[model samples]
Target chain A: MAGGTEIVAHRSGIEKAVAGLILVACAFYCFHALGLNFGSLSNPRSGFMPSVIGVSATVLAAVNLVLTLRKHRMAEADEVALDRYTALNLLMALAGTIAFLVLLDLAGYVVASALYLLFLTKLTRSPGWLVPMAVSIGATGFFYFCFVMLLGVTLP
Target chain B: MENFALLMQGFQASLALHNILAALAGVTLGTLAGVLPGIGISGTIALLLPISFGMEPLTALIMFSGIYYGAMYGGSITSILVNVPGEGASVVTMIEGYQMARRGRAGAALAIAAIGSFVAGTLGVVGITFIAPPLAQVAIAFGPPEYFAIAALGLLVLTNLSGGSALRAVLMMLIGLMLGTVGMDYMTGLVRFGFGVDGLGDGLDFIVIVMGVFGLGEVLARICERQNDVRVTKIKFKDLYPNREETRRSILPIFRGGLIGAIMGLIPGPSGTISTFASYALEKKLSTRREEWGKGAIEGVAGPEAANNAASSFTMIPLLSLGLPFSASAALLLSGFMIHGIQPGPMLVSTEPVLFWGLIASMYIGNLICLILNLPLVGLFASVLRAPMRYLMPVVALVTFTGAYVLNYSLFDLGVLTFFGFLGFFLQMSGYSLAPLALGAFLGPQLEQGLIQTMVLTDGNIWTLMTRPLAGTALWLGVAMIGWMIFRFIRQLLRRSSSQPVAEDV
Candidate 1:
């Protein structure tokens, strides 16, 4: 129970930090908008709407931050449990997407997409190498036929 | 007489051989897509958008129009056979429809839902045919202030109606609005928020976000959750029809649901889902057999299914007439219009009468096709649940990623997809809905343009917003909606507090 409380506290800290980061981002955007000249409302310049939204967003984020902090004080913060395997799977998904992004322009769509699919399939379940390879190849071939051959979409 | 003639001409165009085949293929594919558990209406449309890229605009539209109503029919299939709703609008259908299925009436539930959807869809198209042109004519008189009021009101209502806390919804909406302000300012020709990236000079593609957030994010979420083995009861053809009394009980509810759905569709803000819920509530209130509501009531299946299909059909009005999309699905249709190099607005009818009328005409044919398609294939579609998520999600992810990459062929868009997917997952995990955010992103620029134009016309005087009749009414309606939400929030808070004492005492 004590360990659970500790984990909750740790999660709360992370949550508050994320809220603070949002506030900071809002401030940064507002600062950028302020740098651009704010024309009159009648003849608004490029920055007018952005600056207004930026300010409004900053206020909302501030309110959200306050609410989060208050909820934390009341000890009612919800803890989102992240199991190790699930976390690993999420990271693997992210890695696969990043790899696809890099390989998309380099290795081309078929190879990159196949690699990403294979990686994701393997990450989700411990499939044999053959199954992952077969699935990836099949998926890539289908995408190519539908998108490239049929739809006339250009791919790298 | 003139409108009838116009519709006849549209049928003449829509009934062409190629168009018929497109409609058939579209509804078939759409029903299959909708029958899949994780693939939603918006996600299905987004994934298939690339396939339509090569087709002529009319053919593409005939296909899309088929998919639109076909999804409504397909959604109720899974809801009845399994407890899982294939789409958001069918969530309420699962409540009572599943119970009906459990009582050995799955076939009856499915049949009633299909019939209701067909009735609602047909009536809704009829409503749209008459109502849209007049609405467009009226919209022609609207100035920038009126347009701004309408668009801003839509964003505000979306934020309010989105399921979550008001603060979080507003925050997400503001974030979406900020995201919209990225890229270059059109009026000033000034680059903003590009952060030195060449691709950011043009605003983010809506399709990329749709693919990422709705498609890949959902896939990731599904992957993280443990899959449960769902049991599907085999439905036979002979058992499809309800008894005579059951049919009698359903007819009134179906008509009521269609009426409710058609009206809600015109109002915006998750209209399809809202209409279903509203119809279900209305049915419960008015049903003589209210005692059987939670226990596999036939009215439960009929009303919401009818309402959602009707709502889906009429939801086109705002997009077609006013050039504003109320939901992500409507936004997809708007994107479809833009892809065809035709803008949807008050001038759409005048500018592209054939395209506009042809789409409306095709919807009627699509409805007929969906009814023909879904009623017999409910059993086959329900068996799709046997496919495990492990095998399914990987394919979904691949399609989503490919769709994103193919849109602009930009690695930067892939980056956007990844970022938004991550963001969408986090927001969804935190119990924040993405509909408001999506609405904000879609409507934000239009709202900005309308506001700026109005400002220029009014010389920056904000009070002139209230001086215009239509703009004033819209702004007041928006304010009233916000006020009502605040009141409801406070009342709920008070009730919670009052109940807390009783709980502590217990």
Candidate 2:
């Protein structure tokens, strides 16, 4: 049972592999986008340093993949455990957060955030209309006190 | 003698009504943030940094510093009650602390943590007072080359710090270092990875990268995970303060932690974090009653709590003395010094004696204030977990993004926050420690500036990194540490090999 857990983890290695690849690829994008030449002092190209990082990220991914595969092999003996609901909650939270950030400028911080909170709380297992309303109104009011009144921070 | 007088002046100023109020406000906000899940004090501080623009530098810094230390004190509140750690620094505390709470000993754990924090924090501040000035004296003699060596030594923590895979840690560190090099070449005034965006001209603001990777990224991931609903148990008032028997059990740990924290703080790397972890391991390793450790043994809570506070104080040693930041918060403090146009290195003792010694003296006062406040408010802070995440997260978001906009009134940094937040989330998912990545980004530009200047001065002698005696000695020490790590790893491997066959046979 314990061993099977690691096998479960190995399944998630694809994510790491993908992420590392993206990081590395982004490095190439960053590399091509820069101008590195200067006068006679002759500095290293901007992309040169970044490419090194990109390659390093790629290497890290390869290693991660290897570890993941190895863990998968051991999964039969030692299975990893994951909490599904916890993971699901995290996903909803992320989506809600992204929507909040994207639309905050248009809707304004207080209004946009209220919608984000209202939506997330309602979607979660604790979905009470009161919970979302209280959370949204409370969040806006607190921000108003600290950022608006006390700190005099002008909201976007 | 002059330093002593200046410390006195600083003490007086730190205690002034406005500064004290700021410290109180910082602690209140810090505790609220610490008690809440998914929100961190760093993001909060980043949010408020711009508000200080209109205020006097002293008042502003005093408030931020309070926010900083207050968060540390408050972070334990969350970890002890709920199984979730509100901040990374308090992760270890949550382990034993929640276990203690489960065993119906929440009061005991809280008492030990608060008391130990007070004791170690006081001693740690004393260590800062004595250790910092002399270190500053030595730093005064340092050139850019020496600075580079020190910075390198700090960055190398990525390897030893990687709990699982050293190679991966090194890989992450190198990647982070390269990321640091992105943006404008300060010396040449030329853009490196700016991509012709006018915004890229200044290079990526470390704040943006840091907030994104740690703050926004973490939020995104947290939002997705189905979390346990917040539950904070009540604490009886009588049980809030540790009695003599409990205090006696905790004494040795607090003392040990104080000493360890002081020494670690003086080192160039992320000493505070390492010290806290090491203190916990040491407590567990040395305890005759080992089983009690995971069960929320008072010593377990006491030792690491003390270590954490002590480390916080000692961090100032490097920041105030060498102007070399060894942690993320310390780097930000260094930035604060630069913002105030007070270079925090050797010259601090000479040029800004009042401000410098005042801060040092204020550390002592601050510790006292923490003690006075923490014991009475344990339950209050613990109860903060009752608030819903839906309510908590938005306030945090508004503060952070609003804080970003106020910097240059640019929405771009907010984008940086989202991007880095996702990145931080991914890194967290993959078991990559964002500590090194973040500190690297923060220190990268400074390290670059130092290295470029040092190289030019030496006429392209890469060997200069080695030849300089003081720096050379530090380099050798690093080599020795590596050698020792290899030895330990081999020994561990052999032990595991021998045990493997036995385990298989069993």
Best by DockQ: 1
The 10-residue segment of model 2 chain B with minimum total lDDT is: B497-506
For model 1, the docking class works out as acceptable
Question: Clashing pairs in model 1?
Answer: none
* lDDT (Cα, tens digit) per residue for candidate 1, span B441-461: 778888889888888999999
lDDT of 2: 0.67
What is the docking quality class of candidate 2? acceptable
Cα lDDT, all candidates = 0.81, 0.67
Query: For all candidates, what are the clash counts?
Result: 0, 33
Tens-digit lDDT string for candidate 2 (B392-435): 55445555666666666666666677667766766666566666
